[model samples]
Target: MGAVLQLLSMAGSVLGFVFLTLCIASGLYYISEIVEEHTEPTRRFLTRTIWVIEILLLLLLIFDKFPIKLTIFAMGSHMLYYQNLKKFPYISLTSITFLSSCIVVVMNHYLWFKHFNEVDIPPQFHYDPNYVPPRRATFSQVSSFFAICIWFMPFALFVSLSAGDYVLPTTVEQAKKTDEITELNSETTAKLRGRTIGLARVVIHNVRKYIYSVLALFGIQVQRDYDNLGI
Candidate 1:
């Protein structure tokens, strides 16, 4: 009986996680739609936010005794992210700028994860256990810095940027290819769009479809119509 209860509890946790993931995915999809509607304004805001974060990083580097190499690299990563803004919300996945941005996102996460786990990553001054820095980062300070300066823009981009694959039809052949719109690799659409689509939208669409399929098999009905990934 205890073993059975344990198994049931695990199953419940798994189910809860899956449900929560789907909900978040749906929210991201909705946010992406709103971002599509406000592309220009959103682009400007992201640009300014990048500038602000870069300034904050400089402040930390000079004042907080943050590791110099890591701070510089972080700033450089932000620059790469900024490059994606030229085309604004539409991104070419094959582009070097987009690929570099993705790399830095992972690198930043990995660096911060290690930084937070270890002490004395700073200069020699940090080894003096008795002497605390004048402007040491407290829990809230670091948390906010991590959330806003480090992670915020990347997360925002994930929810805002669309792949360039779904292009506005230009040619007569493309115009007749309504069926190609749904495909990721339709030659006409891919040629015109250059392979851009909302990365997050695609994920949300597929996730919702999978969840709906699973629920349907169990006689559960999902009311949310995510047929076009919230369009």
Candidate 2:
């Protein structure tokens, strides 16, 4: 088990380095895209957020006490929030970056849980042993793992965007303003009955087709898979 753990740690370290490089390369691309360095506040915020996340991941890989549960939750939260935020101010590059981060974060969690199944990784941090799923977590492990994977990163990103941490100034007042703006927009939409109906139908059609395409490509039943995963 010790030797297996060592190998896993080494593999994780290598993967971490690769991820870091990818982050740096991507960051440069983002920075170069900025017309006015000071004007694009969200770019700065996102750069910092990505670096912080990368550092956190690296530290976890290095020390083996990276707070897997908390990190998982944070990553998921960020992903969820960012997805919703695309509706507000749609920047294609930033949106792409957010989506990419989401994919990477989810993949990391999935890989971690998948690897945990093959080898007993020493607990990186102290958690209630009772909180531990089981010696061989198997299906319960993957299910819980993905549950966090699905929701936490996106939600965290959402919080960041709402607070403006991913954009500019993430403060309470800013959040209130955002809320007001969003509410005002919603109210305006409410008044456009005919347009709203048209918009709703268009959204429904696009969403339905998109979902059907995904389903057809990946098989239609998700619930059964969750059950099979022991959810």
Candidate 3:
């Protein structure tokens, strides 16, 4: 019986992996359309394809074999945070929001593995008509990789602010001396203002991180409750 269950679990995992592949592929196509300035229809089609695949994959988690309902809920929460990035679009907010999405995806995968370990599964089954396995899974890690890429924004902001503090003259004396040499010294004041802006950006970035961290913490708590209750 355990052997049969293991086989079934493996089958579900394979299907889940395929769903991930389709999502990534369709996402790439959507991004490509954006990059190439393609027509609205092409971009919309790609987005719709990804959404369909995502919903079907969530169904598999719920009803296919392992009862991954909690994982699906966590995924939906990620989508909320991702939408927050769209609404804000600031570099720091976008970076943190995107990283939050990545963390949520990782947690979902962890839940998938946990479900396989715990649930009783059927021996064998075939995918539905719309489900298609990828020829290679090399691109499967792209989502996580993109999450890593978002980290660069925060890092850059931090470094830029740190360097600006060292190099940008911020003293009242410095400003006064420059004023005596030239009226208002617009160039010097502009450079100082730019540095101040960089410092402000760093603060904003950290604040966004805190907001997303709170969301992620809430998600983890909900996930734990769902797992404990077997919901």
Candidate 4:
């Protein structure tokens, strides 16, 4: 009975992990779509907020209120993220900015993990047996610090950053061109209804290809079809 229960528990754990991974992938994909759709506004908001945080971290460091090393690291990470702004909406996975962004993510995760661990486990001072340790951080204080100082900007940048390979036309002229092409090939009158139906079929096929490309990001296997929709 105990073995059977253990097997069930292990199965449940595996299923839970799969579900969580799917949720994260879907959420990231949705965020990337939104960022691609609103590139300019998203860029401005992220850039401004990052700079603000960098300034605040500098001030805290100046006052000797924050760990100087961690503060400087955080500020540097923000600067790296700022560099990507120059190539906004066209991030190369192999570019310096993207690589730096990846590094900073790991750095932030390590720094905060260490910080929280330190807070939770006070070091023993062998020299002073009776020396009292400082008070541990409250849950709210820890959460606030993690949200604002440790994870906020990094996570936001990760979600906002899109691969250059997936770049899509977002300009007014490009959109107009797409519309014109679609209209030129699609017939509005019943006399040309057969052509319209064919165009609709092609559009549906292209949409399926787009969805398959998105799924490929999650390591899903898909057969590619290069048939272009008239547009």
Candidate 5:
């Protein structure tokens, strides 16, 4: 009885983990949907945010005497990040601008990490009151810096940007075009040429569909997949 109880506890823990993970993913999906819907406003917000960050970095570089080289590098990365705005919310995953931005974010993180570590106070001076600490950032400073400058932009872009399928979303006008193409040649699959929903919607719809189909195959029906729509 004890062994059976232990097994059940472990199984319960596993289910709880899965439930939390699904909750997080669903929240992210919902946020992405909202961002895509308000593309113009999202774009404007990101653009203005870059300007504000740039000004803050400039102040650090000028007054705070942040490492000049690192400051310039951070500014350059922000510039690269700005390039993604040209295409707005929809960025091609493999495109040069997007790939370069990813690389720059990683590089900035490594450079800043190494810089801070180098400036960290040595252990030998721990008891020496006269031994002044190096101009290393404090806990609060580091936290605020990373939160505002280093990590903020990349995270913002991650949530705001979408690498959608190459096919555009079908609309009323595009539906007419698709029908014409289909009529011209039944061999042509114009139906697949466009997606009717956003990328997140597509993934959620397909995954739920596959799960339901699998359950049916196993003669298990927890719920019916009546609606094909997902945000």
Candidate 6:
């Protein structure tokens, strides 16, 4: 029973990791599409947010006794990521940024893991008979720290960072397509109304034809009024 439970637990962990990876990939693809569609706006938003985070990290390094080296490395990595934004949608630059961002994520995870481990460990008093250590981290505290420090920024970036391959149609192309569709619809409407045919009748006639085709696939023969509709 214990072996079965252990196997089940390992399977669940593997599945969860796979699901998380898929979610991150899908989110990055979606963000890349949005970034391609709105290049300037997306770039501006990312730039501002990255700068804000850099400032916060700088403050934390200055005042809080956070690991200065890791913090500085993270800041530099973010600057590299920001530089990639200037040449938006370029494959090489984006890939570099992604690699740097991954490094930054690993650094953050390592630093925070160290911090939490230190917090969890009770301090040792040298050869003291009456030495009392502080209480260990509660479940809530550990969970909150993990969410805020370890997972938050990386998960957010996984969703926010845009890939290079995902492309949206250009604004001009979209406008042209919209105009063409509008013209085609108008022309079709004019032709139908010119024949003194009601729009509802046209829709019903098309629907009936589609229904008959489906019925025919099921070996049920239904009469199709193709000639009388003047389609």
Q: Estimate each model's TM-score.
A: 0.71, 0.28, 0.30, 0.62, 0.65, 0.46
lDDT of 1 at 40: 83
Higher lDDT: candidate 2 or 6? 6
Instruction: Please state the error at residue 144 of candidate 6 in Å.
Output: 6.9
Angstrom error at residue 151, model 3: 19
Lowest lDDT sum, 10 consecutive residues, model 4, at 190-199
Write model 2 residue lDDT over 88-197, tens digit each, in one string. Answer: 22323355666676566666666666556565445763564655544554587457645554444443343233211122233335546667534456555334312111
Candidates ranked by lDDT, best first?
1, 5, 4, 6, 2, 3
- Point out the worst 10-residue segment of candidate 5 by lDDT: 188-197
Give residue 149's lDDT in candidate 2 (0 to 100).
42
Cα lDDT of candidate 2 equals 0.47
Model 2 quality (TM-score): 0.28
Better of 2 and 5 by TM-score: 5
Error of 2 at 52 (Å): 21
> Candidate 3: what lDDT?
0.44
How much is 133 displaced in model 4, in angstroms?
Answer: 1.9
lDDT of 4 by residue, 1-231 (tens): 699999999999999998996677667656655665576898899888987788878886786467788888888888887897786655666787778788888888788668656833345565677877666667897787678766877677667764432212343355466664345432432122221112123334556777898999999988664453222
lDDT of 5 by residue, 38-111 (tens): 77798899899999999999999899888899999999899999999887766777899989998999998888
Off by over 4 Å in 1: 1-16, 120-139, 165-197, 211-224
Query: Predicted candidate 1: what Cα RMSD to the true structure?
Result: 6.5
On lDDT, the candidate that comes out on top is 1
lDDT of all predictions:
0.78, 0.47, 0.44, 0.66, 0.76, 0.58
TM-score of 5: 0.65
Q: Is candidate 1 or candidate 4 better by lDDT?
A: 1
> Which regions of candidate 2 fall more than 4 Å away from where they truly are?
1-83, 86-94, 120-134, 148-190, 193-231
